[model samples]
Target: GFLSGRQENVLRDLRRQMTQAAEELRFERAARLRDQIMAVEQVLERQKVISARMVDQDVIAFVREDGSAAVQMFYIRGGKLIGQNHFVLEGAGEDADACEAVQEFVKQYYQTAAEIPQEVLLPCDIAEASIVQAWLRSRRGSKVEITVPVRGDKRRLVEMAQENALHALEQMRAEMRARLSNADRALRELAEALRLPEPPRRIECYDISNFQSEAFVGSMVVCENGEMAKSEYRRFRIRMHQDHPDDPRMIREVVSRRLSAGLEGEARFTKMPDLILVDGGQGQVSAAAAALDELGLAIPVCGLAKRFELLILPDEPEPVALPRNSQALYLVQRIRDEAHRFANAYRILLQGKKQTRSALLEVPGIGPTRARALIRKFGSVARMREATLEELAECPGMNRKAAEALYQYFRDAEVREEA
Candidate 1:
């Protein structure tokens, strides 16, 4: 009774410590303490006053579902459960021998573990039971026994472990199936809204970003089967009509370049999208359609207007208004937002490069060649600002005097900004 009371007190203290650890945001420490608390609780639950003898033991049970197997171990000390652990085995054959698997697990587990119990209980008898028992006895410095309980408290414990393993496997399978089902439903809804023959497995969205007529860039974001495919995304630096950059011209150039790459069988752009969405109103839709027409392609193109969240199609007389809560509309909005973000990111990168180049050129001694070298070496203006004078001097095409000038320029700029 004293031992049981002491164990309860330790469990209560561990629970309090775990709670405090979680409150302080020490998650790793909290997790370890939580495990200790669980082990203590399990031991208390398995306590049996009928068995006066205090003996340490382990009960192991095995269950298989599909091609996966779960082996659960319940650790008992002084006739009380101390803890439990489970191992999941993938590609374990459906008709594999459970006894042999359990035997192998026991051998491997006991080899590394410091503690070896006086007894081990299994649902089925292991082949080398005596040999394992001897090995365990040698480690424990006392006699060890291994048995398969027929119908007793030990057998009931084994059954419970097996049930737990099966339940865990079922939960995993349910979660996986639910994800696939949701993806399928979303794709179906998208297809029905767009009036396509089937779901658009590969969808691409485009957006253009620029400041006045400078640093014009377009981004193409890909989504396959209701999921964003970041690897397939492409960015283009608008080349045509650079002097007068407009949304229609930028959309046209991006779409044409992308279609040409696909036609030329570029590995990344070889797969044509089932649908193309442009981030604009009617003008963008018409521009994209004309680009595809020039290439003799018949891909479906639509435009999404941000103001009223309207969908504009090339052939439709008016824009289509989707339900506010529709899944299809949500998917379209996500794609459009991602495209805008990607394009804006490219624009910012180019603007930063321009500013860095201008700043370098403003310094009296640095010209185009030295400015390009510095930009290449430093990667960005922020990095150049943080660089030491010695590092700047060590860069190619830079000497002590030039390095000091470059460093002083950034320092002065910082002071000016602060002022």
Candidate 2:
């Protein structure tokens, strides 16, 4: 419409200016104008006439896979498909959480959106439809409709948006893998530095987390081709004494159990890592090596000390140091950091469960069984604490007396906190 208006030759003249700039050696200016030209062309290509009312609308759909999601939005202006945009959200959960992903995108996106359309179309039903509609209406200063079309033309549009979203997500993943293709250089450097038979294609790093001597846990994080292989990650609850956890012994036990499971052909642990990295000095490396020896496995074992970034090999008494800024050392450090993060996550989860159990067990008529039931039903301590007497009584295996005791306990606790 703008082209058909007074500035009909704007795009044509813009292209001419870009070509003239290149001829005059203004490459940077030409490149920028070229980008803007391409953007306008893409907008033109996305336009398509459609059947709809006078109200402007935005159709939203998303696809999720492997902890990432892509949301596709189609803008409809005056019954025409004007254009669309795609957004990516990492750590957005799986396909079953599609509604939640869409809800999140909607809430966060509209906060920064320049304009709110009169109507919005969704691919699936969301629990906060009414709330979102209310907010949208307030923004628009009039009524706004949010619809999930079950059939017909609008449904087809939503399906199209979903397909586009899925395609965009796969493209993003492929681009990421392409960027990581240079991992071969890092792998080669590591192999040369360590004098290995070949580069370690699958490297696993382990770290331990605990408080004083309680809730000791070990985490094994994997890096294949310089990218984190999160699905292969494993966590262990130290079966040995937690009252005074021995770091080396805990590392040994975790490594032994993992290797044993793989040896026994466990479903998820059947594949052994090419190299093992422990988050400690010589002692941790020795412990991991001992585990391998007892199992008759010959995997390479190494340790990365936190301070000074020293690499400790099982066979070498003196620590081996790589270049200060070598990719090989950087890769090792990245893997170690991932292991630390995973171990801390597991530790935090255990600590939360411990606190929940302790708090619930203090309530009269609530034992371990009820406490476990409460956790299973409510999924968190905060949610359970907020449950009313009727809600608690309705929980599985909970009687009126136990529910009343919990209700009264929280109520009195709240009163004391207020005081």
Candidate 3:
């Protein structure tokens, strides 16, 4: 071999002289001798080629609570050598012992590599390829191959991961499909739950509100595409009964008025509703349905039963129970609740005015007729404050003296009230 003891000793001596020359700044001579030293080292590494190429294809088996895994590696042959190359056997733990075990294996392998021994197999506690690569890199070594294979228990572990991944992919695809589906089909499903003919793309829900049926009012709210169409909403004042708070009769009146206006092509209520919803049980729904029939309209009708929040469809054996998280259920609930709130708010507005005006009109000089005339003339009590005695006299049926006296009384009353 070129790396014989005599030749190696000579090369070492040449290196030492080159170092001394560099210390003394002998640039030209140092450069020449450094080339000669490198030539000798190159020859020495050439003689060690057999030792480098005879590496065993080492394999490692790893086990965890999950399963088992394995890895394989081999040494490279024929390269310019300055230092040794190291490769990690995958499926090893991150503990210090796992590190030391690999170090010992590499060291022992290199020492007896010339003997061409059989492959060495080790037990690894971890199976992650990244972790194995990290451990090998820290050693400043190269020319190694690392691999982790699925087999035995390790096969089962990877199989589970693949199955879960497949299932997740399927679910994601299903969600995408849902978005592209027709909105009409979704509404049809909602209609089926309510036992309506086909799906109701356009729906109007009505709700009545009052304080003991005194200042009763009803509101009609429209919904399209499973959402509120706020612009189509309408409010109606109950001009019928002010005594009996019968929701059924109230529904009939409201639905009849709404349909009649829609049939007449009123600007705001021109379009006909596909379905009608009442915020009550079967009785209210029947009343509204009869009204629609009387108007010669074939609209489907349903009711949102208050008890248990059930959807009561006409002629259905039982109420349809929709899942609480369903979009269809939420859509109907929104329409019902909004109609109820609007009706109640309108009722409150009328009641507040009635309470204020009814008491004031009961005064000796001012009866309900005079009170109505005064309100019509003044627009509001606040505006009445700005009216002169002559303006009050101009109001129908008010004499000049009576108008003066009435104006003075209100001015005094407003002052006392503000105080």
**In terms of lDDT, which candidate is strongest?**
2
| TM-score, cand. 1 vs. native | 0.59
Runs of candidate 3 exceeding 4 Å displacement: 1-189, 195-199, 363-365, 376-379, 386-402
Residue 270 in candidate 3, Cα distance off native in Å: 2.3
- The local distance difference test score of each candidate is 0.84, 0.84, 0.65
lDDT of 1 by residue, 161-257 (tens): 8997887678557645644555566668777777889988899999999987789899999988877789999999999765666899889999999
Question: Per-residue error at 217 for model 3, in Å?
Answer: 2.0
Positional deviation of 8 in candidate 3, in angstroms?
67
lDDT of 3 by residue, 220-242 (tens): 99987654678988999887885
TM-score-sorted candidate list, best first: 2, 1, 3
Per-candidate TM equals 0.59, 0.63, 0.51
Where is model 2 more than 4 Å wrong at Cα?
1-178, 394-397
- Provide the lowest-lDDT 10-residue window in model 2: 19-28
Query: Which order, best to worst by lDDT?
Result: 2, 1, 3
**Would you list the clashing residue pairs of candidate 3?**
none
